[model samples]
Target: MNSIWVITKRELSSFFDSLTAYILLTVFLGLSGFFTWLYGSDIFFIGQATLQPFFSIAMWTLFFFIPALTMRMLAEEKRSGTIELLLTKSVNDWQVILGKFSACLALIAIALLLTLPYYITLSFIGPVDHGAVWTGYFGMLLMSMAYISIGLFASSITNNQIVAFLLALFVSVFFLIIFDVLAGNFTGSMGQFFNFLSISTHYESISRGVIDSKDLIYFLSISFFGLMLAETSLSKRNIVE
Candidate 1:
């Protein structure tokens, strides 16, 4: 098999073999649907319907959920002594990383697809901006990539899944609303820095209606930085083992 497909198959199979995929889809769909319909009002304009209710709720939900999905990506491999075995195979560090990342992204994409009913409902109740909704979906995809990368990094740092989960959650959440969360306590440059660091700032800009290039760059950078950190940590592990 080719590199991408090789990782894709492994990750996809892993999700089905365990109950993780089912649990994530159910929880995400149920919660997001509730918030959108109960809170946003189907008939009323919901600021793109995909923004305030769908994308906004997704931000908070992904903060806790993505880590759970990814905490075991590498942590479990190491804890099981499988990391060493896998390393000895033809796959290099990046192949392993890409495979795992691709798998997680596929699962996330599936979860996003399951949320389509919300859009159908919006169409039924009133006219919705198809462009904005599409953009919001793109923003969610970017956020997923960024979160999964960070979660993978956290998992790489240790063999404990719970530790991996919490670490990823904290990092993702901090950046998710870093500025808004810290803004109230400080002012001026400090506040400016916090705002600059917040993931929400970039995500919100994209979710509004347009696919801004700068926002795309920020997500890609964070995702790259995250995966790079994970690869570095694994390299250290290889040397020690």
Candidate 2:
């Protein structure tokens, strides 16, 4: 646990010490704010008291932005031959993965927190569904966890940051688009199955201000599965070393 926190703090500090964190936060906030307030689907045009527009924009923005943020977590370490040095510090694979994951999540949480003014402004203009807004944030957090895990796994599999980014984007696209489309085209059990597998499906369910156990389970399960794969990949690298 201490090792994990040490790595987490180090990674988090490194993020702030470099331009990576700033770029990610700026782009994420800029796009999310633009689409939520200035774009065609702006809240004023929607005539709703909900943060649905922002949520919609956020979902798309995260799809691209998150991979960029996570692309170098392990890929760069491996490329620069620093992963071995990292491991030499009494840190196990799972601890390293968890530390990196926590750092990314913390960064994301900070980004999300910066958007609170949106909520505050929305509340002043109209009746905002506080419950829904809370749940929506929860859903986004879950979505981030899932993406971060997948992104970490992508990084673990390659020593090239660009390849890791592309692979993460490729993997995320399946959950973001392919599964959703397949779910729509299927029928009965097939539809149900695909829908169950779709991240958006669970996200929507939670965003409705209703926290379903199944939805929670789905997000956690996907995150866990991805992390386990990453751990396995790192273990293999250790064996090869």
Query: All models: lDDT?
Result: 0.84, 0.91
Q: Candidate 2: which stretches are off by over 4 Å?
A: none
Root-mean-square deviation of Cα positions for candidate 1 versus the true structure, in angstroms: 2.2
Q: Residue 229 lDDT in model 1?
A: 95
Residues 145-177, model 1: lDDT tens digits: 999999999999999999999999888878876
Deviation (Å) of 116 in candidate 1? 1.6
Each candidate structure's TM-score, on Cα atoms with residue i matched to residue i, is: 0.92, 0.97
Give one clash count per candidate, in the order shown: 0, 0
Over 4 Å off in model 1, which ranges? 40-51, 184-189
TM-score of 2: 0.97
* lDDT (10s digit) by residue, model 2, range 152-200: 9999999999999999999999988898899899999998888888888
